[model samples]
Target: MDPRKQRSRDRLYAAALELAAEHPIADLTVTQLAGAAGVHRSTFYEHADSPQALVEAALTAELDVLREELLKDRADAATAVAKVTEAVLRHILIHVDLYRRELADGAGGLHAMLSRHFRGTTETLLERGRIDLDVTVEGMPPARVADAAARFLADGTVGIIDGWLRHPSARVEDFLRVYAALLPSWWPHSPAA
Candidate 1:
């Protein structure tokens, strides 16, 4: 939490974002990132072992700002989907370049890491809520419902964001409509997925 470390990370994140504008997550490397930030290669390695890690850190940095400023609202269970839709649309709109660089690359992108966190976040919410969640493991007992729901929500969000990233200027309503119509069948008890 040192201010110096924060500054270094900020510089690296900025550099990564800039380079992602031209290149992509898979194409960008730690050496290029360090050089872009004017930091030594060792410094970049001190923070992250690979370009994926660096990109993850950069994405986490950007998401913090978005979560605080844009996704601060918490709604009731019935309306939570709306809040999520708004927040996700804003996230995609605000960071489409980063999304494209990280998530649009299929499995090797940032979506894997970010979607795991998203699933975990949803699990926390379900644990603290009154909703009848149906999260379940592949072959385990019923204690894993929250984690399972988290994965569904996380991957669903990623897919939506991936589509939106391909069409950055589309209306939020359009995405929300498409998602609302398609997501229920993929939920826990939605007719065998």
Candidate 2:
């Protein structure tokens, strides 16, 4: 990628995140994001086709950073999984405002997109032996179990998260408790239990 273009995209991503934090995703516009990033309206078009596309790019970039954070300082399989799951929940909590806005607006299947990204990251971890799993998917080959597990967990996780987002009383701890329930044997039970 060209350095200058990369810089512009990076600015746009950062600006999108900032605006997302402050305004509803549906209410945000390309002009607002471009102005926030100190770039021209045409420059944003050079990077993304629409405001939703820009937001998706920003969210994807944030998720990439979170993936790196979760994979750092590798540990046992259970510990690693616990860390990754917790990091995901915490990341969502930190961006709860944006999530609520997007979910309420029906902003283009964000949960599905997140699930896809998570599945890809988890599959990579499994293939690289970063996360060890003893279970196989149905009668499938052991080599492909990682792919299957990733799909199951990623889809399930996103579904649970979307439910929590819709619930008015759901908090970060509530979300974490639901996630932790999936891996009860991984760590000490939470206070909620």
Residue 126 lDDT, candidate 1, scale 0-100 = 60
In angstroms, the error of model 1 at 20 is 1.1
lDDT of 2: 0.75
Given candidate 1, what's the lDDT at residue 102? 60
lDDT of each: 0.68, 0.75
lDDT of 1 by residue, 1-193 (tens): 7998888888888888778766767788878999999889988987888877887777776555544432344544445545554765676666667676567666765778778656755665565662456445677766565566667778987888677667747678887677777665424222211
Clashes of each: 1, 0
Model 2 lDDT per residue over 134-182, tens place = 6755778986765667788777777778788888777777887777777
Give the 10-residue window scoring lowest on summed lDDT in candidate 1. Answer: 184-193
Clashes of 2: 0
* Runs off by more than 4 Å, candidate 2: 1-7, 104-107, 137-139, 142-145, 183-193
Clashing pairs in 1: 135-145
- The TM-score, computed over Cα atoms with residue i paired to residue i, of candidate 2 is 0.77
